[model samples]
Target: MVGHTLELRGSPFLQEIIREVPGGERIVHCLQCGTCGGSCPNGADMEYTPRTILAMITANQRDKVLKANTMWFCVSCYSCVSRCPQKIPITDIMYGLKRISIREKAYQETDAPALAKTFTDLLDKYGRSFELGLASRYYLFNRPLAMLKMGPMGLSMFTRGRMSLTPTRIRNVDQLQAIIRKARELGGVS
Candidate 1:
């Protein structure tokens, strides 16, 4: 009889971890060539650039990166990946790193509390986002007073149907959940 390999617990399956995301392995190819840093609109604002984050993760310094403002400042623009000579998926790394940071509660941005609650609640309740529901949830989560300060201007667009009232779920919700479960198991956000 052939013996099956034993997988240890809490021991990083680095290969499995990298394969969890579609383009994560590309992060390993970064040369620290500074292309990502140079292309970022907010480069001057970050102590550590996207390239540096990738380097830190590879060095097992993920906690250090999680504590920094760099992840919060990323605008989710794909410019870094688009211009990467190594074809590294810098944007996805930024997202994965942010998920880890938020999951750990290592860094908190005050403006994000409403957003975080709304996103989690959306995923939990409807298995997707309803734009109007999200907006209302965010406003309410932030409190009535906070939204009241914005006056009629804040309520205008949402009331006009610029934001849809419908909830949309991706097809194959179970598969999506399974993928998300894998991420959560690895200490990443759903």
Candidate 2:
């Protein structure tokens, strides 16, 4: 675990996050049991594990917590949440951290923010994911070289009928947009 050398103080930042996230108040009950960390699929890539992030939240390591890549590493697999004995809604907390990081401009330089934006843009525009479009857009800006590398794999998937050439729009996309709009108005994930 990375050392949290930040000065300790009361964290209104954490309080605000707790209020924003569904089931986030349960964060205060974290047991430091390491289950969340152990259960995380990408735990090895995180600067702080889920358990450590919770501790940092309680310890008022606002800057460290906000800047850490732990939040970005979360794949939303819900493994940690399912394994948590305290049922702390670890994934939701990760989402809250991501939102806070974006709002505060505190995250490290990474493709995560770009990928998230790309996904949301595609979803909002088409009412569903368009993998080819998403890959094209994401690679155009983030890693043009990676696009070359992915060509063979993409071709393989296409040949195998595992990848679609066209995006499938959901029925009643206007209703989907309305629901998303209402969720955003109600302080749901943006």
Candidate 3:
């Protein structure tokens, strides 16, 4: 039988994760119990499970961990975080990994990153997501032909008042932008 390992001594990747995520320091307490991975709704879709990702981090497999689709597949449902015996913030670690991957361009040819960027941009601009704008911009740039196929659905949604043609900014958009700016500054993200 194996016990929990505490080998966070020399891994720069682990340290970076600790710094990047809000509660990532708790990751060292992980028991590798596979609870987090098993609790994940999208674990099967990921190239690596949350448990394997943590092991990779301890092993300092920086390139493989960052390039894997594990982080991108996380839906931030917090199922893993809620179930972990060590109380590790697995979902937040996934977010930290995503930030690092985007910063390092460690991801391969996946539409997740591009879609995330578009969603964030819209959120930052309008203080909320503009679904129509998001879908239009994403499909227009990512899959041009797909946009044509979506036109009818988009029109139907707009006609039914389920979607809006233009974005409606929040009353205090400046405040929201300020908050976002401060977050970026503190995160050391550009």
Candidate 4:
């Protein structure tokens, strides 16, 4: 991806992220071979591809890296992680960047953050995805018109039994909550 060059500087941000993410220290081993970029499904839409993000981290471009939308664009598919010659946990690193961005409020107003927050809230509450609830809450704030546009499709899905009207609760919901709590405590994805 063509983008602005970032100047190298001291960044406690990068060091903190590396410490938080498992295998994040491997970022220094990136070959800049574009393997992660090539493997990313949404690479074309990112301001910086995974490879470039690694380069930015190495260069300690904390402000630019945190403000960029590349981390939010990641779908967490792990294609880059599996394809990386250096075996960096690119997906986990993306999550770490996301957490930092949210914490710092460095990101621009975008639907991706809202969507992630909605999904996480639903998961925390129900121990499973509540699709209808997610869509309602997400579109309610992000794009009210999209809700109207999706009405027909949502109706069709419900009629066709493709969508459930009621959410299904897991039997071991307490166990799920405990796991989620532990992960949060360990600085895993929230």
Question: Best-fitting candidate, measured by TM-score?
Answer: 3
TM-score against truth, every candidate: 0.67, 0.85, 0.88, 0.83
TM-score of predicted structure 1 = 0.67
The digit string of per-residue lDDT tens for model 1 on 1-190 reads 1231122212242243365456776655668899998999988898798777766766656567778777677788889878999988777776666665666677755456458667876885557867677767787766667677755764687687666657887677788678677876886322
Count clashing pairs, candidate 3: 0
lDDT ranking, high to low: 3, 2, 4, 1
Ordered by TM-score, highest first, the candidates read: 3, 2, 4, 1
Task: Point out where model 1 deviates above 4 Å.
Answer: 1-20, 113-117, 143-146, 158-190
Best by lDDT: 3
Model 2: runs farther than 4 Å from truth? Answer: 1-10
Candidate 3 weakest ten by summed lDDT? 1-10
lDDT of each: 0.68, 0.85, 0.86, 0.83
What is the Cα root-mean-square deviation between model 3 and the actual structure? 3.2
Superposed model 4: Cα runs more than 4 Å off: 1-11, 178-190
Model 3 error, position 64 (Å): 0.5
lDDT of 3 at 138: 95
Q: Clashes in each model (backbone N, CA, C under 3 Å)?
A: 0, 0, 0, 0
User: On residues 1-190, what C-alpha lDDT tens digit does candidate 2 reach at each position?
Assistant: 2233222224676677667688876776777999999999999988889999988887778899899999998989999988899889889888888988988789887788889899998998789999998999999999999999999999999999989888889889999899889888887632
